[model samples]
Target: MISSDAYILGKIKEGDGNAFSLLMEKYYSVLFKYGLHITKDTDLIDDCVQDVFISLWQIRHKADSIQFIRQYLLTALKRRIIRVETQRKKTLDLHDYEFDLQFSIEDILAERQVAEDNASRLRHILDQLTSRQKEVIYLVYYLQLDHAQVAEIMHISRQSVYNLLSETIRKMKDFWENAR
Candidate 1:
């Protein structure tokens, strides 16, 4: 049986260093990618991820039970990135950032020629979406997170999450239909 994040967190609270290491390894890449979407600076993103983990270790005993570790780490990473950028007098609008997520169907396809054209077209359509729309899609679809989790991570209401997702899907459908 796989151990849950909540269980690992409990062990960390008990001063288990191995549990802390496991937590860091599990979330580091996901958190780093999320931070990259918020800030273009690689060093800044890396630093913020490290800071989040360090802070988590320091506050393990006082931290409340975390039902969703990915959401929790993402929220922390976003906050850390924002706080750091704010201190440097950078613009604070969430939509002001760029998203660099890459989607490739070739990785999933055994025969490259079979899906090459479709993948290219899909990539082009995805590139047409606004940064906010892409971010919402990435979190909700690629990350497989629910509306509530995405809302908390994005600092938006649940209704906003639904609205954004709806609009994104509608736009994609329209684009795809027109393309066909």
Candidate 2:
């Protein structure tokens, strides 16, 4: 059985380097992929992710205090990327950046043993959504995070998260119906 995050965190708090490695190993891919959705510069994302890990390691004593590890990492990465990009471009508004959510629905459907045609159709349907809607779909369904956590990560209110999700669902339904 895979070790629980709490267990890994316990070992980390005790200064177990391997446990920290385990934590990093568990989350690196997800964090990186999520990072890709936010920014086009892979190098910048990589640097930000490494910096996040470094910061987390520097505060290992507080590992146990984090109730949502994945959410915390994602939020930190998002902020880091925006900060770095803003400074690099000399932009004053962090909200000026757009989420470039490029989802590979075929890969996801293939993993679930879904047929190719269905994957193509679903991808087509999803392609109709706004970037914010797509990001909400990814955070809520793909990441399986709660609405409140998604709101916190996206820097939006919980009710806005709900509204976005509902709007996405409505649009998807309309698209699917029209496609038939």
Q: Which stretches of candidate 1 lie over 4 Å from their true place?
A: 1-3, 90-96, 105-124, 175-180
Writing each residue's lDDT as its tens digit, candidate 2 over 1-180 gives: 434988888888899999999999999999999999888899988999999999998999988888889999999999899888788677756455677766665665667676667667778767777777878888998899999899989888999899989987876677455544
The TM-score leader among the candidates is 2
Model 2 clash number? 0
List candidate 2 segments past 4 Å from native: 1-3, 89-94, 103-125, 177-180
Model 2 scores a TM of 0.82
Clashing pairs in 1: none
Candidate 1 worst ten-residue window by lDDT: 105-114
- What clash count goes with each model? 0, 0
Question: What would the per-residue lDDT of candidate 1 be over residues 1-180, giving only the tens digit for each residue?
Answer: 434877898888899999899988888998887877777999998998999899888889954477788999998888877777776665575433466666664554335443556656667766777666777888988889998999998888899888878876886677556545
Best by lDDT: 2
For every model shown, what is its TM-score relative to the native structure? 0.80, 0.82
Look at candidate 2 and give me any clashing residue pairs.
Answer: none
Overall local distance difference test of candidate 1:
0.78
